[model samples]
Target: MDLDAFVSAHYGEWEHLRALSSRRTLSGAGADELLDLYQRAATHLSLLRSAAPDPAVLQYLSTVLAKARTASLRRRTLSWSRVADFVVRDLPAVLYRTRWWWIGTALVNVVVAVLLGTWVARNPSVQTSFISPAAAQQLVNHDFSNYYSQYGGADFATHVWTNNVWVAALCIAFGVLGFPIAYVLWNNVVNVGVQGGIMVAYGHGSEFFGLILPHGILELTAVFVAAGSGLRLFWSWVEPGARTRADAMAHEGRSMVVVVLGLIGVLLVSGAIEAFVTPSGLPTFARVGIGVLAELAFLAYVFVLGRRAVREGFTGDVVAEDRSATRPTAA
Candidate 1:
């Protein structure tokens, strides 16, 4: 049959398959039938392409193919809706499985911060070069100390919450731009380093802990998590793995989103503490203890509760049976 004739004859069946694919669960037989039909259609198209028919016939075939492709894509999008649920549900499981990666990234950030601190201690002038004179002067003049003292006020807490949320959102959003994630990570790492250096420079290394540790640990840890999520998102686009780039990206995007959400949660809590608790003239040990408890709680949620919730949501039963035995195995 001619390409146009073949397509016209099968068009209704194609539409039916397309519709079936949109449903949440397709029976094995239904999936098989759809695949069989697709293969037949593909064979016909291949034959038509090889024939190099008249321009009019080619044009008609092209239109039909385009329509079929569009219908197929629509169905795939619908199918992805089901897959997306699994993605969201299994996110904590995925992150737990990849804990080493997250830990490594955070350790790197901390190490870099320490190294920067050491470098600044050795060469005090480098601080002036890195930060503006006005900013450096402010740091030297205990402006941060004053700011933290007033930080726990209602207005200051609101401001900190708003600003930190913006930063967390930007880290996740810019990750979609591929290369920009690198810049985001670099900026965050350097900021941490500078903060560490400034604390040591002011001879308030211990006092700095009292002022910063209450919120800094959680806030900084969240930043690392944000950076890791960005990296995962970028890797999805650049997929160096076995899967195609598009497939890899779709898979990674799901897990990355969970990480981002978790980071946002951490940021919110950290911002509240930074604004309200840090400025309360709390003792160093009290701040450190609070910070440790908060950090431990976050870890528990991320690694334990989150993981269990995901597994419970997505896990399916496996049924096994011996064909020769007349009894079925309980799932």
Candidate 2:
């Protein structure tokens, strides 16, 4: 248990180990020397623990050995494979699995918007409830179409993209609370319905559809998807099925975050359509047809690629190695 004598004997070896560890590159001899010193230091640490425990020497040996061990092990290099795997497999799989949740939300929102719009268009009192007759006329006559063409195409696209992304982000971020998502969906529904009704009432219904449908189909679908993901996330916490509540939330939350990233791209396309195509001189049929095609393409991506991915066991969460280790809890 002579700590000073032991330190004196091994100080040279310890110093060598530290030097080797600090080096950025190692020659064959240097690598061999590092391995030998690392092993000796480990043994020395064991002896220090058992026979002559000096805190300073033990601490120094531990740090040097830890560094040496790390250096000896090969490190993994980053690659694009992870990103490719996510886009090809994980993203689609999660979207497919959650298709019902969002599809239902889409249908319900559309129906509500349609009914409310029709009701408002049919009733003068309801039309006047929100908009004065003068304002309504102004909006119908000029503001409706002018809104799209007011800004340059690029600026309008960027503006719409940013705004829609913000809404989608909020849906995911606040989705843990169930009612917030419902409120968001309701607000969107009411806004669309009121606007549609006002436009139809003033006999600009054809023009309104011409402007909105091109971008609105995909844009609204993205919103619905986000709302669905958020609501399902809340439900995961409420009814975790076979998994623990924490597990369910972790799985669903990760998947939804990925959906948020994917939706950015989707919303970007929609914004482009709104900015460039909707306001362009394209015929109404052509414009609306383009939107429908884009919407169909997205649906196919989910139902085709997504279904296949789900079948292959992708779930849109982080790769297994990246997920945090968790203690198992009973469901």
List lDDT for all candidates, in order: 0.65, 0.89
RMSD of each: 11.7, 7.6
- Worst 10 contiguous positions by lDDT, candidate 1: 315-324
Q: Kindly list the per-residue Cα lDDT of model 1 for residues 151-214, writing each as its tens digit.
A: 4477776777677767666766776775676676678778767766776776757766677789
User: By TM-score, how accurate is candidate 1?
Assistant: 0.62
- The true-versus-predicted C-alpha distance at residue 37 of model 2, in Å, is 9.1
At residue 15, what lDDT does model 2 achieve?
86
Q: Highest lDDT among the candidates is held by which one?
A: 2
Please count the clashing residue pairs in each candidate, in the order shown.
2, 0
lDDT of 2 at 46: 99
- Candidate 1 local lDDT, residue 107: 89
